[model samples]
Target: MAATVEYDVMMAPEEPERSEEEREREAETCKEKGNVFYAQKDYNEAYNYYTKAIDWSQKNASYYGNRAATLMMLAKYREALEDAQQSVRLDDTFVKGHHREGKCHLLLGNAMAATRCFQKVVELETKNEQARKELKNAAAVLEYERIAEVDFEKRDFRKVVFCMDRALELAPACHRFKILKAECLALLGRYPDAQSVASDILRMDSTNADALYVRGLCLYYEDCIEKAVQFFVQALKMAPDHQKARLACRNAKALKAKKEEGNQAFKDGNFELAHRLYSEALNIDPNNIKTNAKLYCNRGTVNAKLKNVCKAIEDCTNAVKLDETYIKAYLRRAQCYTDTEQYEEAVRDYEKVYQTESTKEHKQLLKNAQLELKKSKRKDYYKILGVDKNASEDEIKKAYRKRALMHHPDRHSGATTEVQKEEEKKFKEVGEAFTILSDPKKKARYDSGQDLDEDGMNMGDFDANNIFKAFFSGPGGFSFEASGPGNFFFQFG
Candidate 1:
């Protein structure tokens, strides 16, 4: 059986065609070239080679997936998403296609879509560590964003920092996270922390306008106004359209102006000018507690110097309103009230000063004011006029008239002009006192602590000069006036 059968045994002509295998080899070669370009960061060339590989072999989902990755690297996220979708359509089981699509969505800032794609990849392959990690990162970013938004709205800057920290932990290379951290720290009044964060961001991105602007605000809060202005100016240089930087620069300049002007005025002993400048500064920055306190204190001192007793008390009251612990304001207000003859109010202010923790100088001043207030309560204006408590109305009038005649300027013609003017003022006061006590109704009203006009009306709208003339004038009778050098009296009613 083996004899003749070997005769016709000829090797079947080897099949010479391998078109599918050849195409696959060529696609793989193109794919390798694409990977090389991608590794070198030549995305355009990588994209071209990946496209060629995909065109040459439709069945290779890897080629489409790699092309999408290259597109994503070039920030052509929409196109990359389409290619990745095509790869998934070709073979839904391809893990790389799903990962690439997810990455594309992430690059496009579609966190929800990216999360869904990554989650699906994790679902399909439990051992897919990369997919699992991506899902976790995407979900953390979403949660952080949501919480941070709410925190920012509520002005809970501390919570904003905590949420952003978690986000930065998940995406350490995110520039936005760094910028947000700086802002949150600044809002929390952690100026030094915010400055450090902003500096780190600037190191990573020298032209980062938001980071520079935030750094400026941090510097401003730290009281480094000049340095803050520099940072804001730099930020404006980087981005001329940055509104925040512009506003910060303007505010910083204003603060600097106020500080300089106020310091100079204070140095020059211009207390009123200094007070106004400090007030302007406080207006620009209402939260500046020191400036507010200084302004009130300085204004109080100026009012005292100007002899505006009530105004001095009011300014000191405002100082206490701004800072209840201001011992100086309480003491100053007490002194002003004492000067204005407000003995009860002055006693109250002095009591506050006594209770306050004050320096030795302030304590001594407060003690002195309290003693003065006690003395003021016992002061008698009628006793200063040297009138007896039981003096008859006519007797009181006679005593005042005698004193006025002795000090009358016309009676001292040889005296200096200044002495004459002083005497005339004293004579006028004496006449006014006599007029108030001579009339029985006026005397009763005066004794009862009621002001009575010359016409026996209430003192409302009564002019002291008009009342004096009406009291001395009788109907159809003459009032005395020394009109010439001689002691001759001319009278007109």
Candidate 2:
């Protein structure tokens, strides 16, 4: 207690509070200093002095107007707009405040609002040439906004870009036109041009959320997904209610997660799960063509693993359609065609692949498809069996049984002679298919494009009727006529 009393005794007297008149004078002096700094292009120092003037005289419209001008010079249009608006609120008849407000509104793409502000400036001072010029620019901006809205809805991106360019010529400082032009350029696949426009805006105003979003879009189109997401996040941070940035960020994150999950599933040999995840990723942003192409190709790989060769081929074809230079899609589709004995189609795809990549692997694939095409001109046992060359023995047997039962001559005895003859021909073909494909040695020779005659087992030597009889025969004498197709059983000994 004694130490506290001794400290209080040594305390100095407080300075007296300044009178309102003194504060007003100090505020005017600070504003004059701000004007000097502003004239010298020292926007930061001008902003600080203007802020000090506003703090000293909170009701002074001129101080706020000066600060608004400094903010505009610093390219902080939104903040400038706030200060400009505050100045107008303090004194509605302040022409300079109204003019600054109009400028901020015009730069921010609020053409209607800017028009009102400039109209007020003209109402207060009829002969303001600068306000008249800004009003004309605002009118041009309105026309551009209208035209751009219509063209953008119709997906006429090129026309939108043209309109934006003209609007920008009238209001060169307008960020809205630049952002719209960049968005249209991205839609038109001019990613570099789009990036250039966005980067220019960012150089002046790094915190412009619309410009950041446009830059993200360009990066996204360029297949820089991670970098695009970063930009989108930054835009969202600057403007929490930015719907485009929010949706894009969500899609980018979901796409990346699904893609990674799909790849993990593929690595784990879970083809079904991988296919589903990849399909989900594709649906996340279907407009992202390059990303969707890779997803389609990945799904095709999963389909191939799942033994869905036709679906795999279809997916790979879609991948190729999305990105014609997708070499993996071409190679995968060619392999699928070759597997399915579509040698002509396989050769075409392989030729396309060879044109892109003249590697030995591609060359060999082309040669193999060409050889298969030549071989395909002859009797195709696998084709007759309705099975692929990679079909297992069990799959071959099942196909043979099904084909034989459907095409057996006895099954069509009630039909006309022409129908009976056709059924008999198909039946014989099925029998011959089973004869070659059911035997591993014969299947190996057939797959190698070798003649069975070289192994002393010519196609002519195999009796289709006898083979059919042996395939369906049971202990005493099984008859296909007595047992309908559905009632047939394997004659297990």
Clashing pairs in 2: none
* lDDT score for residue 97 of model 1: 91
Best by lDDT: 2
The superposed Cα distance between candidate 1 and the true structure at residue 6, in angstroms, equals 71
What clash count does candidate 1 reach?
0
TM-score, structure 1 vs. true: 0.44
What are the TM-scores, per candidate, against the unseen true structure? 0.44, 0.57
lDDT of 2 by residue, 66-125 (tens): 899999888788999999999999999999999999999888778899999999999999
Query: Which sections of candidate 2 miss by over 4 Å?
Result: 1-140, 153-156, 378-493
What value does the lDDT take at residue 396 in candidate 1? Answer: 76
Q: Pairs clashing in candidate 1?
A: none
Query: What's the true lDDT of residue 456 in model 1?
Result: 54
- Local error of candidate 2 at 439, Å? 19
